[model samples]
Target: MAAIAQERYEDSYLYRLRHSAAHLMAQALTELYPGIKLAIGPPIENGFYYDVDSPVVIREEDLAKIEARMKELSKLDQRIVRMEAPDREAAKKLILEETTLGQGPEVAEYKLLLLEAVPDGETISFYDQQRTDREGKFHRFLDLCRGPHVDSTKEIKHFKLMNLAGAYWRGDAKNKQLTRIYGTAFETKEELETHLHNLEEARKRDHRILGRELGLFMFSPRVGPGLPLWLPKGAVLRDTMVTFLKEEQLKRGYEPVVTPSIASIKLYEKSGHIIAYRDKMFPFMEDEERETYILKPMNCPFHIEIYASQMRSYRDLPVRYAEFGTVHRYEQSGEVTGILRARGFTQDDAHLFVTKDQLIDEFIGVVDLMKTVLDKLGLKDFRARVGTKDPLSDKYVGHDENWVAATEAIEKACQTMGVDYFVSPGDAAFYGPKLDLIIKDALGRDWQMGTVQVDYNLPERFELEYIGEDSKPHRPIMIHRAPFGSLERMIGLLTEQYAGAFPLWLAPVQIAILPIADRHAEYAAELKVRFRDEFKLRVHLDDRRETLGKKIRDTQMQKVPYMVIIGDRDIEQGTVGVRSREEGDLGAMSLDAFIERVKSEL
Candidate 1:
């Protein structure tokens, strides 16, 4: 069913239009830079990008020139024709003779490499675009591609080149870097304009910019990339989430546990992480006794060890250990984006060891808890994705039966829970199949948040067991869950989703008190204490020697949910002037009335 939905998009004209737009861009690049070597160009989720080894350096300013040329080429009505080569030798000959556009063999470097990498049984195909101008000058563009393109370049209109980026060839650091040109296309001018407008709005909501402006977090060059230093406000937000999740876990029968930040290398080796996840892990360190240790990349192994430490019967079959474990991964500098893709982050992690009979119930409980968490976070737009191992991939461990059982268990739980999910192959963890919540924020961009994985393999690898009714040892199933995925990434999403104006309960400062004058400062201080201590609200007292309007503006800029102004008349009347973030100022209200209003919002 999911494949059908995916195919609907893949078979749509928009898809072919974007694909042909890539070809149109390539044609423009070839005309602009004669010796440019086009590597690969494909239409992506929201746009398309083409990587090319250009003869001249491409800059942001060059994008305008490229777009102008693309616009002219798109209207030329050149026929987009697909051709196939009979064999590898014919393909190579076509690439050198036609794809190079008479520029020389050196320009076909990446294309020949692409041809060599193609499987023997696959058809060798190319996309050919050729035309003669009204002035009788012949112009042609051909490239090696398996194309499902629009029939004419005239259909490749309403497109804009977005930006320029550097991508390593074949995504290998050892290979030469190619210039990546990103662009977006739509079927109509209105859609293209809307997309460009959204791109601008996305820039404004960029967490990296908002993180610093809103005082959430910061990245330091000295501390290293992908390591965020949470400011006071950001720490408060994190604590709020942790407290909420911890309470939810306690209610769901999850016991808290603490583990070391670093574990012995042998521990990871035993769990198979040393082999499957070695690349993402930090460098190993050796102690005085020649024992090697690695910074934690996952908290699952430690939780598994704890479960194995105790001997249990079927009566105590399900044991859940929850922790806010801080882990580090060696994310490449290019891959790290502020807190969203941080190297060091805390996972709201838990591992459940349960008998096969208890698997469905426990999995349902985890999904319920995840829904509750998302509701509280105000993330209502989301979908579930079931990630299964690719049949051709050797990255996974465990037997085929174990893998099948795990996958079935997950699908059953989702079915029982009536949760809609799409199947994604090659997205599973090395251990087992999993379900991930893909959230759409305010900007309509998808972020993979909470996750739950059913792992029979891990328990088998660790020899985890429980005594059955007949007193025979049986292997237990493991459910690894993290509803928030990670605190840093969640906070980043929240920041962008709400644009820093957090809800009443989740806001770092629920209310700010501004004093009208020096004499009002005393009353404001007292109100702050009442709001903070008596009402248990995160309140701030703005008693700075600044103007009243300035204080209000500053508080509004901070995105505080509420503000109370204490003045001579308000202090005399035993009332405070209140202002709401979304609404304008409400007239003076009695202290009790204001408290009740705040309580209702909470």
Candidate 2:
């Protein structure tokens, strides 16, 4: 029934238009490049892309030609028709005959290779765009696709071919590279134009671009890929975020702790991560005595060790240990795009060890804390993803009854809180079921930012126990939660979400005092000291020997929240002119009044 609903959703008018645009693109490719071997063409989020093996290397310059052919074909108002082939042999024969006249053996070889991969007992389908119907109408060209496309080429009027790039045949490094062309379509020209505008805006706020422009972070080729170096400005922002969360955690009964960056390989083995997540983890190093050590890929195992440090009773069941732990993982080069997917990052992680009876309440508390953090960060649009076990997979750990209980506890908590969530089968961690928070950025792209996992296997593996009312040893449940999944990723998202204009409290340089001349420098310095000492605000005195306009422009470009312009008149009256990044300049105000405003904002 869910499959049917998905199919119905895909058959919407917009989806069909995008799918038709994909076919038109493939048709244009075959027509322009005669013998282009097609691999796959499927509709994606905004539109569709087709992968092709071309004789000549395709570049951005070739997109215009393909797009022109598409426009000409669309003008013909061709009717798209679908057909079914009884067997692979029949499908191959039809494709070979149609493509042989132009491309011949190369096209036939490609068709045969695809034909051999089709599963048995499944009907092969093709779509064709017909030109005319004078006496007996026939399709000018056709390609294999299992699709629900638009009625005709006319529906693809508001479409465009975006760009081209090299992609692996099947997204695997082992496969041959193919030229992939991306494009987008919409039901109306206005919608397409709006989407393009949004794309342009997104490019401006792209973290990689903003990171460089703002001098926040950088990557060095010598240091290797997927590793970022935070500059002073960036470090200030990171520290501010960490300090805010740490304070919040402390107020909510979390005890701060620190852990080593590397641990013995045996630790991961006991946590079941070495066996389950070996591919994503860094390799172990062999010492002189043959001891193996690994860069910790996660902090849960270390916290588990802390929990089992000594014997505990039911009174200490709800111990919450928090850490700003840095971990390293070996992500594939292709997957390491930016700070969002880095090699080394810090997790705002916490582990709560509780008795069986305290599981639900503790789980609910974690959820509440997650909401509080998100609210403080101005993230109100989010939904929870309840990751459950996949019965067919061997990746899951823990007993079946424990898995059931953990999944039920999370669902009950979500229900009791009246929060909307969706169940995602097979997305659970190896140890147990988890609840992940999915946040949408300013560009409307969804990111999985925070998570809370319920683990029963870890306690059993480590032999964690507590004395209960009956004076018997009982295993405690482990709850793993990270509000900001990783500090690096959170900053990257915030950079784009806020468009590099962070809130005043979080901005690296909250206020810059720009002295109009050298004579006013002393007053500016005094004001900076006053703000920094009293309010603990990040304030800078711009004593550069530059004009007031240039100074103001420089500070504006840096995106400092506020700028105080000190001139002779204001200095004489012991007042300063206030200027804001968002709002224009306000009239002169006393130093105390300005400090009060900063305090209010903070």
Candidate 3:
């Protein structure tokens, strides 16, 4: 069902509208900035972007001017017509002549390069937006694009020019950088307004900003760009999440294990990562003995070595090893964004070695665990993506038969679990097929979260075997599952999902005790200790010399779930004033009663 929905989106009218919007924007750019070199422009998931090497600098302030021009062009009712070239030479001639609009051939640099990249015997096409004015004047904007655009630019009335970004031509760092203009279009004005509204909300909920405001984490240039140093409160948040997952794993029969941060390079070579994942790995390190080592990019290879160390019978077939293993990757500086795409992070990684007959049940169990994790994290809107190997790609390591079997196993598990899933080709890991959880947050933005993979190639490569019912050794299949994906990323998403106001059970500081005056400081400290020792809740005591209103305001700003007020009346009456983060102040309640309320929430 999800796969069909995704297909519908690809062929939807909104897709064509956005495609035409890109062309309209390109036309506006050319008219506004003559002799600019145009590159590729395509419709994306949310909008469209056009890459151009402009003669003049393009900045955010220039977006309104470009948008005004687009409006004029859109109202002109230009008919967008598609034309095909007879051959590559004819395509180049059309580009240099029609596309450049009398500008020198130098302006068609990127277009000619795009033409050369097209494979032989494929149709080369262009979309030409042409109009004839009532005053007997003619105008046309021709672009090298394989487009399925709307008939007329008049339909692209509801659109907005978003912003500007620097993108390297063809995404290569070594290539010349070009200005990328991003814009969005919609079928209705209401949708465009709502999208813009959401963009504002997203800016407020950005995790990087919230992390610092909430004292969760920070990044220092001395350490690096993609590495985060967890603050005190942030460490508590991480520990809380780790405890929850560890307890759940124990209940599900997962044993804990630990691994080193670095390993011999030969391990990755055996796992086929050296060939497939080398680009993401850091530079190789060598010791005095000349043996090469690498910062581990993944934990599966380490777990495999532990499994291969022992020879076992059918009883120990399904061996599960769980680890909160830290791994490193070499993300491009531009691609790193806060903790979401950190260079070094810990994965809640686990691997299950099971017999072929036990594969289905084990896979189903892994999926169930993932569901429980999402539910606990307050992420309810989600769908599964079954990532399978692209048939045309040579990067995969497994045989055709193994790939089919692995892919089939995942689909079967999803069906059994009644999971709504879509099949996405070319999204799979090099060795196997997997199911990824795509979580939709409060802002309606999708995040790829927990994942489960079924692999037969790794066990085959490592020769992992177990004795079967027939008393013969048989290769076992491996299941890789990570519920939280990574601690840093999950926390980042949660920080944004709840806008830093975490639930009572998940918040680093569950309650704050705010004393009205210095005279009440001793009582506030006592309550804090009681909350921490008896109720086992995280609590903070604000005994600083401040007014009651200021103390309450400061505690509220921290977004604590509950605040206990200490004053003369409460101290004498053996009661506490309670304030809720969402609701206003509750007049007064017994300390035991408040503890019960917090327990119920947990």
Instruction: Give the number of the best model, judged by lDDT.
Output: 3
Query: Which lDDT tens digits does candidate 1 get at residues 1-602?
Result: 12213455778899889989998999889889988889999999888999999888999999999999999988889998889998888999888787777677999898888889988877888888878998999777887888799999998889999998999998998999999999999999999998888889888888889889878888889999999999999999999999999999999999999999999999999998998899999999999999999999999999999999988899996899999999999999879988888899999999999987898788889988998999899998888888999989997877787778777777776776666677788889887889999999887789999999988778888999899998999999889999999998899899989988899999999999999899989888888898889999999999999999999999998999989999899988999899999998898999999999989878
Off by over 4 Å in 1: 1-4, 8-12, 34-37, 53-57, 92-123, 132-139, 168-177, 391-405
lDDT of 3 by residue, 1-602 (tens): 32434766668899999999999999999999999899989999999999999999998999999999999999999999999997898999899889888889999999999999999888899999999999989889998888899999999999999988999999999999999999999999999999999999989889999999999999999999899999999999999999999999999899999999999989998997898789999999999999999999999999999998988788987899999999999999879999999999999999999987788789888988888888899899889999999989998876788788778778878888777899999989887899999999998899998999888788988888988889999999899999999999999999999989999888999999988888888988888888899889999998888888898888877899999998999999889999999888987999889888889989
Model 1 vs truth, CA RMSD? 2.6
Clashes per model (N, Cα, C within 3 A): 0, 0, 0
lDDT of 2 at 253: 90
Instruction: Score candidate 2 by TM-score against the native.
Output: 0.94
- Candidate number with the higher TM-score (1 or 3): 3
- Order of candidate numbers by lDDT, starting with the best: 3, 1, 2
Candidate models: Cα lDDT each: 0.89, 0.85, 0.91
In angstroms, the error of model 1 at 553 is 1.6
Report model 1's TM-score to 2 decimal places: 0.93
On residues 441-504, what C-alpha lDDT tens digit does candidate 2 reach at each position? 7777788899999988888888999888888888999999999999889888889898888899
- Residue-level lDDT for 431 in candidate 3: 75
Candidate 2 accuracy as lDDT: 0.85
Can you tell me which runs of candidate 3 are displaced by over 4 Å?
A: 1-4, 8-10, 102-106, 116-122, 172-176, 392-402
Pitting candidate 1 against candidate 2, the one with the higher TM-score is: 2
Q: List the lowest-lDDT window of 10 residues for candidate 1.
A: 1-10
